[model samples]
Target chain A: MNWTLLLEQTLNGFQFGILLFLLAAGLTLIFGIMDLINLAHGSLYMMGAYFAATLTKWTGSFLLGAILAIPACMAFGMIVEMIAIRTLYTRNHLDQVLATFGLILFFNEFVRLIWGPIGLDIPLPEVLNGSVELFLGIRYPAFRLVIIAVGILVAFLLYLLVSRTKLGMLIRAGASNRQMISALGVNINFLYTIVFGLGAALAGLAGLMAGPIMTVEIGMGEGILIITLVVIVIGGVGSIKGAFVAALLVGLIDTLGRSFLPDILGLFFSNDVADTAAPAISSMLIYLLMALILAIKPQGLFPPRGA
Target chain B: MKGTPRIIFIVILMLGLGVVPLLADYFDEPFYTVMFSRMLILSIGAVSLNLILGFGGMVSFGHAVYLGIGSYMVGIGTMHAVEDGIEWMANGFLQITLAIVFSALTGLVIGAISLRTRGVYFIMITLAFSQMLYFVAVGNERYGGDDGLSLYMRSDFNGLIDITYDNSLYYLNFVILLLSLYLSHRLINSRFGMVIRGAKSNEQRMRAIGFPVFRYQLVAFVIAGTICGIAGVLSANQTEFVNPSVMHWTRSGDLIIMTVLGGLGTLFGPVIGAVAFLFLEEFLSGITEYWQLYFGPMLVLVVIFARGGIDGMLVGLDKWWSRNSTVKNEEID
Candidate 1:
């Protein structure tokens, strides 16, 4: 394999992983702190993309549209929480699953009603449309570079928010002992809404950034949500650090595996056979990795304390 | 639980289904017969799902994998039975036998790995496995690949039963549905049913009482898969086609909806759920282009308010009616 191609794929994987990290962070936090599984989280991500596409078209400023989607998503998430998610907290996981499933059905059709079944487009700003030289002989798309840089920045800021802030402490405490924190007179319901809102915003942010690169479509969020779930499962649910590492690992493996598995398989199989089988096998690499990890460490690579 | 109301309900439902074809003939709307037949086929799927999800407390999200596998068996088996270059490999009987048996075997393998995890992990793992199978189906170029495989002719029973006709196929589905419902009913009341329920309610207690919980759960999983595989055979016969989309996890989600909407842990719950769920889809799609917009929110309200589903709500109504009648009698006295 060419070294330059390898380097480019590595960067692609990094960018993809960062987007996953954004999705996983929110999912893990909501799951971690609230002990609730929110399948509708992907719908929030889809909403963000739709919002960005719509606002950008209306205002003719991509940046302006992206900025406005955060609050819109947060507000949307909280309203949803108040209306439906609030009822799920006291119920069992099965009930949570079914209810959120209903929400998914609702949002999918709701988006269809507004945006129609076709995908929307987010026109990239001229400034971020070109490629940038990453190495002497290699170039990378400027927008993808921006995504990686922004992802790193978000990761850094998130690290600070969780480690050094009082809200972080409350979040950590809530994840650990919900009853204790509630008994201590902290407004648990408000905290939950805030956390859910924050999670929605992160998912939204990921959506907006991803819209330019990927087709901003009806089921786009769901396609990525499965991979994000794998990331969190590998990283250990409720642990941001775990989510980050696992996201990166999954991203790298998925990208690299797709690119290289066929060539590797070619050594043992005929070209026709390799070409046919490689795509299926490589696509399954992450799941196989998950099964392996689960077999050895059923709790995952980095389960949260007490989880 | 008292059986009178349930018995009355069953009698009415069976009668409704039995006369649907005659009614359709009178109205000259044969489409309703096909629709009811589809509902019966799906009811079998929902019932099988309920066995594991409700009674066994194993919320497998990939139950449709078996359905897909079963359909593929029909497609591939029929292809082989023909005078193809590949040689006539097997009879339709053997193919179907393999479908049901193979699905049970697959359940055992998948259950062995997945049942080790619980809650969300189990859900995700099952989903992942189903997707893996979906991709596999998508990759098989010989079987039509991404486009899916179409059957040349329906599975021939060698004149034992004529399944080429829609009405005949509908009757087959009806008979199978009744047999499965009866089988599950027997299972639910048996000692095995109690153990499964006991494990669901309290796994640790079941284990503490010297029950090999995992083995029992795995067997239940296998049984569910087998029944669903049978449903798949009916579905393939009904549709005259088999595609990779058959195993999509969303369809699995629909199966779960049937179980939950009908009533969890109840014998007749999933059948009611399938009917309600399908009937609503039929009604809404008839009225609006964006039916899911209405249907989705309605499902949410059901989960929120009718938490016990249509089956539970009906039972509650029965109890309420009996209590009110007794109170009236007391007042008169």
Candidate 2:
């Protein structure tokens, strides 16, 4: 393998992992704090991409589009939470699944109605469009580097918020024992609204950032959402740290396997056979990893301590 | 009046279904005959899924995989016979038995692995496994890839009814649906089903009582998967096509919706649910292409407001009617 190509792929994997972290973080938090499974989380991401695409088109500024989408997602999330998801707290996971599933259909069709099915594309800004020379031999896109920087900064902020703030303590407490948190006179409903909105904003951020790289379209969130679910399963349910570690690991494995598995298989099989078989195996790789992980640790790698 | 009203209602419903195809023939609307045939086939699927989801409390989000595998069995079998001149694969009984058996084996393996995980993990893992198969289906260039292959004619049953004829397949599907419903009804009431139901109600308790909960659950899971695999044969035969979309996660979701909408754990609920849900789809899509928007919220309403679903509602109405009559009996006495 060419060293430069390997490094570039690694960076690409890292960038992808970062986006996953953004999406999975919210999902884990919602699951952790609310004990709710929100299948519509991906719909939030889809709406964010659509909102960002629309805003950027109108404003002619990518950064502004992304910035505006965060709050927009939060507002929309709060509305949805009140209208549909709030009542699901008392019901079983099956009900939550169906209700949110309904939300998915509604949102997908609603987007189709507004966007007219033909997908939108976001162009990278001119300044970040150029390639940056990292060293004498390697070059990478400036936009990707910016994404890395943003992802890390967001990660840092999330760490600080979760670790240092009083609100974070409340969130942590709420996650473990909602009854105790409510006994302490916390408005559990308000807290849930905040948490749901926070998760939605995080997903929206991921979506807005992803728009320029991938097509902004209906049902786009679903493809990545399953991967995110695997990340959570690998990382351990309701653990942000696990989500982070798992996302990166999944991204690296997926990326590297896609690039090199065929090459490795070529050593044993014919080139034609290797070409055909590699992709199918690589596509199954993450799920296999998740299954293996679950078989060993059904609760996941880093399940939140003490419930 | 002495017996439960829901049973009375079910008898009426089945009788109604039995006669409708006959009525359709007389009315010259083979269209509705075909429609009810499709519903019956789907009801078989929904009913099988209900065995697991409603009765056994295993929320298998990937149930449609069985349907797709069943479809592909017939699709690929016919393709082999017609295109490659492979005679053995084209035998309908062999194809169906292999499909059901293969899907049951897969169900066993999948059940063995997935049953270890509970709640949300089970749901996600099942969805993931099904999706994994879906992608494989998408990538297989031999079987038409993303665009599905078609069966020129329905599977043949030698020296029996000609299923390729329009209403023959419909009647056959009705018989199969009736058989499946009867089998499921018996299975649910059998001692084995009692163990499964006991486990579903309280696994810890079931384990304490020395029930091999996992084995029972796995068996139930396999049975449900096999039944769904049979339904998949009907679906393939009904549509005369097989594609990855049949196994799509959304289709699995649709199965769940039908089960829930009908009433979990109650006999005949899923069939009604399938009819209501599919008929609504047919009606709404005819009115506007954006039918899903209405469908999505309507599902939400059913989940939110009608937790008992159509079957549960009927049961509740029966109870109310019985209570009113009992009061009259007291007054007369």
Candidate 3:
């Protein structure tokens, strides 16, 4: 519990929080605009990681691989929307859930077939392979710092695109009223496809960022997908600002809780009790937060105005 | 006109299931019996889920947690009996009671919290709670942690019904399945069932009409979880092992698929769906290890093209045949 250690953990949490925000922003946008639940969004994340891994190896450059993988994931997302997701818009939520659940299964197996059962490891570039001295003898991984910076830049760009651009105007209109916008001559379906692709690209970006730190493997999407879902729920579904705030909160709480809870519990409980209970409790921390939040504010902390 | 075809189909299915044990013995292939027993156990779980999802209009994504709880009750009880010499812990009746109680309590807490939200929120909340339990199970080292625990012995009922034997266990599963189907039929057609169904169709309207909709839904959720717990007990016995894998969120998805494939809101649909799904899994895996590649797309197609599932299709066929016969009568006239 030294100052440097605490500072380092806080930075780690912030870095992790950025990753969650990247996934959540796209998900919230898609949910807001189309009113569709895409459970397979995580598959896109997994695909991005795999694509980045392959592209990186082939090109021998992490930046180029990521640049290529984003569009690839976007195209894949649009294709999925046209084929499977288009019909689900009018269907009930349950059907949408089941269909997306199927897509998850399909994507995982497809990845396994293509990538093999073994996980692919993405090696960081030489420039980011070392640690950076922040200040006062405290150092942080340079790669993680890059992730935070990229995440913040992306978040800023997303805000501009959603609020300042014509497409963003249409997106806002669609979220508020789909038929009204369609009646006004906007190609809502095409717009949906683009928005869906954009969401996929964002998820892909998250996967690409995560690749160097984590293994790129089949079913990687599902593990993070659930957490993303939790983030959306906590953030008040379909609210980007809510998503951003909630994602960071959940990340910091999860990371910090896991790191410090056991030691804190040891002060009161026996060593064995603290050791056994900490992991279980820490793993449950965010979910418990979600439950408490939902109980108190059923519409979530920052539900969309008028919703 | 009286749903004669559906009744006949049910009769045939029941009789076929009834003779599985005897047929397995005659063919000297006990594997079919074991597999069918597993199917029946899962069918029970699916049926419980249908009570909430199909009829009650509550899509609980964590229904399988009760199954895990049910399995662990027996698993941990067996561990205590063997290792700590607690003979009473091995009693099948007590194990089942504890499992039912724990499952009911969990369902109550989950339902109370999740039922407050509607649609996608409910789904995500339920999933989160189950994932919470899953992580807890993965972290508990005393109960074998991530690796799960092996039940050294099945719970003994002391001759009330010896489940150690395959045939007896199979019969027990059959009887329970029959009883559950009967219970579901009675419950769904009752006044209470009407309230739950009404709420599913239109919750606001139900509430406006002075019905305590939340209470009814919570009751249904608890009942469903408890029944799934019974299935869990049988599942643990049948598999002779319990692990964290049983509680995985994917397993809950499997339960949803089975319920939907059989025919949502239909009493006997879960059984049919379970049997068909398990058989399909076995058949596909026999052909290739990467069966999910085929299976996943098939599910997507079912959602897109075939909404009613197997039972719905069967009912549709019967309607078509009866309509054609009436057409012939009109021509003759």
* Winner by lDDT: 3
| Ranking of all predicted structures according to lDDT, beginning with the best and ending with the worst | 3, 2, 1
Model 1, A134-215: lDDT tens per residue?
Answer: 7696999999999999989999998898889999889989999999999999999999999999999999999999999998
Candidate 3 wrongly placed segments (more than 4 Å): B1-4, B331-333
Clashing residue pairs for model 3: none
Estimate, for each residue in A164-217, the C-alpha lDDT of model 3 and write its tens digit. Answer: 999999999999988999999999999999999999999999999999998888
For model 2, name the residue pairs that clash.
none
Which residue window of length 10 is worst by lDDT in model 1 chain B?
B83-92
User: In lDDT terms, how accurate is model 3?
Assistant: 0.92
What DockQ does predicted model 2 obtain? 0.80
Candidate order (DockQ): 3, 2, 1
> What TM value does chain A in model 2 reach?
0.98
**Interface root mean square deviation per prediction:** 1.2, 0.9, 0.8
Mind giving the per-residue lDDT tens digits that candidate 1 earns over B1-333?
555565678679877877777788799998987898889988999999999998998989899999998888888876766647333333456656888998998898889899998888888788888888888888788787888877767887767788887777888888888899899999988999999999999999999999999999999999999999988888888888889889887899899999899999888888888988899999999999888888777877888788778878888878887888889999999
What clash pairs does model 1 have? none
Question: A1-307 in candidate 2: lDDT tens per residue?
Answer: 7889889999998998998999999999999988888889899999999999999988899988888888999999999999889999888999999999999999999999989999999877899889899998588989888888898899899999988998899999998899999999999999999999999998988898888888999899988888998898889889999999999999898888889889999999999989877877888888888888988888889989876
Candidate 1, true inter-chain contacts retained: 0.55
Number of clashes found in candidate 1 = 0
